[model samples]
Target chain A: MTDKPATPRRRGAARTEELLQVTLDLAVEVGYAGLSIEAVARRAGVGKHTIYRRWSSMAELLLDALSRAWTSDLDYRDTGDVRADLREQFLRSAPALSSPPIGPVYRAVIAEAQSDAALRATLHERFLVTVEQRTLERITLAQSTGELVDGVDLEFAAEVLCGTLYYRALLTDRPIDEAAVDGLLEMFMAAYGAAG
Target chain B: MTDKPATPRRRGAARTEELLQVTLDLAVEVGYAGLSIEAVARRAGVGKHTIYRRWSSMAELLLDALSRAWTSDLDYRDTGDVRADLREQFLRSAPALSSPPIGPVYRAVIAEAQSDAALRATLHERFLVTVEQRTLERITLAQSTGELVDGVDLEFAAEVLCGTLYYRALLTDRPIDEAAVDGLLEMFMAAYGAAG
Candidate 1:
């Protein structure tokens, strides 16, 4: 009994992964809003009910795809200097949101999530909150070390930093290069920190 | 000859507006990427040739729709204070980007444009550049009169400002309220203005 159950469970998990991979492919090739479970099944050569059994709806399936797109090891290394630390973390994560598999998925969700509260909840819960918390930690460290200014709203600052990145990545075709990142940090530091 | 041409010209113009209106409606209801020329023609009750005759592609149709979504008369009143002038301009344009007819359409295009070059081009050309130019004009006015720092990169500063709004309007469902606008202006003034 245990052998039979385990083998099928493994097969199911493999199929789920395939479905997700195909979902990301379609999201990049077609678009987030343009493709559906039917389309995904058609592409992946699976029955539509396969996705429905695992995920509640198309949005949930996409959310699952997006959440898996990033490495959960997004822990920022704590350098002695706050600016360098933040920049390092940014460099690490930038590619995930800008590349084909993940970036397009993220862009699709952000585009759809704007109007759909459920999708936004999924984004905030599964993804964005972690980034926000990390930034807050960095800001707090900077404040204690006399890098950041006193009395700045740490939450708002973190939100703005993430918002600015999302603004560039999803909204504009502007290149989010090192120079642009430096400029963003400059504005952020000037507004939130005092130069030592 | 002029009179004969004018009748069909007026009819063509009216039909074009109707098509744009229908495009916006579909964009808001069905979203940007998913809806096609066939869909638009179906909703607008016209032959597919009608759309093909005027616009080469669905991207071009959505571009035409987005282009007309804004009130071209978004003139900022020349208030003596730069902050006040900028704030007033934000107030004027906030509604169009936040509500239905235009807001959803803008959101849909922004979401879809992330992966499509032609759509991004249309967006950059029609919407973003105008906002950037206006913000640059404000920043320059403030700089020449000694309100802002002398060496600030006027273009970048403008881009950041517009980026922040697009961040809020498209990425997050955060209320782009008066208080939020005030905070953005505060950051802009502090970073760019000569407060030291």
Candidate 2:
């Protein structure tokens, strides 16, 4: 059989995936502060222009790497019990955030965002907002079904629920384990649970 | 009047104060990522050895600067009400965190800490631990007084209380405003408030 030549589109897609994987590996090894286009290019054996052509800045490139490597489902499962669903989701995704390529890289990005306004907005728009919105959707649905108390500000509740996890994960040495998750959900349910 | 010659102790103390002030100013201007002993020396017109003499590393120097500039009272006032005290404290100290100098510098250090184990430990030991402890003390007292619900984990409570503010401050663009504080306290009270 004759070998078929790869089309330009296929080649471009393959190259993009390779570059993203390289970016993730470098991020895990050296962190975001140590990462630069030159370092990635050297590691990938590609010209600096090859990276710049694909990404306008290091933040963009790193974010793409994060997006590609993020295998956890951001959407919450509708398990009928809102608290159980949130607990399941938190437990499922906590490892990705607490360890490895994702945890360290995410921390670097958040840290960088402290100094970079443009990056902060992008992170908010892309990642945090999605999580917050999903939490809100789940909680709002529960409220509508009379599973939660009416007249309470569900938005604030959503922020606290999501905010507490990020707080434990990023700010302190405290583990976001079952105990922590239960403590949060207990407070949440107490505050928002329907009057029985 | 003839000028008195300064004692070496006084001179040394004054020089230390000046260096700290310079460090704070530069931290506000360039942030933690841009800060270095060399840069501080250049800005203050002192040799690098001067900074090295006082602080072993940039993290040490920055932490000292933070300690010096941290004028906000970390201790909660025993105003006979746990919720009110927390609200007052959060409101009183929110500006120091959300505004320049302390806010920006602290965020930079936190970002740096993600990859730096030593800095993270120092931060947790020197700053976060103190805040969490004080919070625990106040809440524990409230529980004893029957102001808060008994049997709840106050340590976890303390973490969430402090963590949520930091989450809004560092991780998201959400304003740590009166509304945010009130909402947090509301959930806290609902969950932990003594039942009538």
- Which candidate's lDDT is highest? 2
Score candidate 1 by DockQ: 0.35
Interface RMSD, per-candidate values to 1 decimal: 2.1, 1.3
How many residue pairs in model 1 have overlapping backbones?
1
lDDT of 1 by residue, A1-196 (tens): 6555557888898888888778877887877768898999899898888888998777778767766666463566767677788787777787787776777667667767866767776676556776778788878888888888887677767767777776666656776778777787777777777765
* Predicted structure with the largest TM-score when compared to the true one: 2
The C-alpha stretches of model 1 lying farther than 4 A from their native spots are: A1-73, B1-56, B72-74
lDDT of 1 by residue, B70-178 (tens): 7463556666678898888887788888677777767667666765766777777767777788778877988888888887576877777777777766645576789
Task: Report how far residue A8 has shifted in candidate 1, in Å.
Answer: 20
User: RMSD to the native, candidate 2?
Assistant: 5.4
Candidate 2 residue-wise lDDT, B1-196, digit = tens:
4698788889889989899899999888887778889999999899999888888888877777777777456758998988999998888887777677788788778877877777877787667777788888998999999999888888888888888888887777777889999999998888888988
DockQ of each: 0.35, 0.53
Alpha carbon lDDT at A153, candidate 2? 88
Candidate 2 lDDT tens digits, A1-196: 3677778889878989999999999999987889999999999899999899888888878887887787455668887899899999888887787678688788889878987877876777667777788889999999988899888888888888888898777766777899999998888898789878
